[model samples]
Target: MTCSATTRVALWATLLACLLNSGCTGTRYIPSQGQLASPTPPPQALKGFDGNARVELNLPGGYASPDDRAYPTQRANEDIQNWFADSGDDLTVAVRNENIKDSGWLSMLPYILTLGILPTWLTTEGETVMEVKSGDEVLFQNREPVAYRSALSMLLPSAYLLGSPGTGQYQVMADDQLNRHKQALQQYIQSQQKDYETAVSAGTVQAYRQYLQDNPESFFRMETLRRLSELAPATHALPFHRDNVALDNAYIVYLPDEYDIWFLGPQDMKVYDVLRLSREEDETLLASRIRAANQPYKVFNGDEIALLKEGGLSPGLIAAMIDASANPTSVKPAAVAPTVTSATSGAASPGTPSPAEVTAQPGMADIAAQCAKRYAAMKACDQVPSFGANVCRSQVKKKYSHIACELIQ
Candidate 1:
């Protein structure tokens, strides 16, 4: 179909115009750089962006249920008192207001729904103060007895004692409550000590050991150990031999001390049974027993070790536990493995600087001076210890040990 030049030119022009207007052809898709205009505003407010919005921190298991109403009035009073004590002054009212306003569940309900239910009573009255006198002397003055009672109830459950106001009392009763509580605890400890003595006198070591083994979680462990340490023999014969020395059980007996020695049972079948050796020979004999047939052996200090031993742990495990117990600000768990060296032999050698020794050792004065010279370099010494003249000695020794071992091979 042959067309005139003017007609062809006109058709091409129309096609180009259509493509440009539609933005459908010959268009590259480049992402927009500038701010984009939204068709609609954001559907919901972003978290933390709602600055004026109220925040509610709900109780763990929500409000008490019908089953909890057995001691309804008392429980409610206790809860109110606990809240006041913890929040400190006017907290009950503030919390109630917050709960009503910010709670999503409460807001969704009809206004009439709140009117149908009885509202919880929260006392707004400031702490009451009272003053009292006995004869010519003033015994007590205006005191917030309720607040103190509430605080004590929450802080110490067993220690809180209820008291009745005396005749014509204008002030809260002042009794020796703290002294009474302390006396009660002391009495209990004394009673426990007597019972422990009786148990020791009446039973054999095996019986006592069995009692300890069975009731591992008993709070009496420390007391029992104290008693045992006192009763343990003072002297031993050389090459002392004891039958059925329960190493695992002894671990449960004493708390870990610096001088405590753990004798590990042999690793292989041909190796000897494990024995725990103390600094004192007699104590070792007391703890040891002749190896029994068919007794199970553990590779690492397991639950058995923890259950029996005072520290109930191996040297490696004890070191880890000690590191864990250190203050978070002073010590970090991640740094423990790389720092502390467990004493495998008699004691860690003085010549060898353990990871702990390395960390604990202070930087040299020269290093500190060099660091002080530069404003940005002040904290550089904290990265590693700067030893004085003895620097690099350990490193060189370690290298030599490796070389010597290789040469001998």
Candidate 2:
């Protein structure tokens, strides 16, 4: 069928517009020109935790579960708190809301004229005061400014993208603000690490106290406490126990300063065995082992459990491991004790390659190399005398923790 002259002209114009605007297809933030009317405050160095941090998020009206979203307050609270949940309660994080203005369709004329090739934004602007407190003392408080804009174009499916349109405008703004807050927390935690290591090097009771005082939510608190006890025994006191203490203190157990592994030692064959079991999603054998607690391994600590969890172990298995630790059985020494050495540290050592450090076989070589390289970096970071070696190792392992080599084995 032949088109009319007017139709043909329109078709050519449409194709030209698509080509011209191809660079701006996705729903993304428009680059800010000049300065924002209200600049967001940079995230400050404060007390925070990594994977094992116990955080209690407090919204304006108080705690709200993600599962219970019946009310507007609960729904909004859940949107902000969903990503921040972890294991510890070193600090109480409160998010106070402010006025949020929804700027709908900045300009309609351009979009109409360009036949949806030119995009328009649906924006949500707001500010939130994120206050972190250790007991009654406010450790770090900052204003997190939220300016989220979703680009709408016929070529861009905004609804399918994160922070997209079609949701309640307020919810979109809250989610973006929360994400920014999460990033800030990460930066804040890293900044605090340098000071923590400095305090560790000082190796005095006062230094440890200062670190604990400054970073109420530090992942190194348990380590600091142990040091403090060794330096000044009388001052050591029991910390308040929570429901998930095993999960909370897992960081400490998994990455001890001494690279000691008693079971299947000098080689982390047993460690790889657990990783393999997790990959197979079998927790029954683990439960059976937990029940028969005469196994010649040291009771799994919180950090060990955390490592297992990172390596893909199930929660039930972790719980069983925790129980075995809590209720110990008199372990008879193995008839022929396994060698205990640095070989099980999960990093390659000279002379012999640890089982865990062996290069992946065939097709899986690339991932194994990446994993081994990352673990080596973490080990190097831990070797720095003043650094929180355990903390560094834990954080690094969290990123590339899965035992990829276990797949081939």
**lDDT agreement with native, every candidate:** 0.26, 0.43
- For candidate 2, what is the lDDT? 0.43
Off by over 4 Å in 2: 1-91, 99-124, 133-137, 148-165, 168-176, 202-223, 231-409
What is candidate 1's local distance difference test score?
A: 0.26
Q: Kindly provide the TM-score of model 2 when superposed on the true structure, using C-alpha atoms.
A: 0.30
Name the 10 consecutive residues with the lowest summed lDDT in model 2. 235-244
Worst 10 residues of 1 by lDDT: 23-32
lDDT of 1 by residue, 1-409 (tens): 3568889999988875443222111101111232221222111211101111111212112122223212222322333233221322111111111112112234213312332122211111222222212222322232221111110011122111221111111111111211222233344435655765666675554555554555443324434433444444444311111211232232222322211122211122111222233222343232332122221112223533443243322344333223322223332211211111112111224454433432343221112111112111112211212110011222222222322122221
Residue 96 CA error for candidate 2 (Å)?
Answer: 4.4
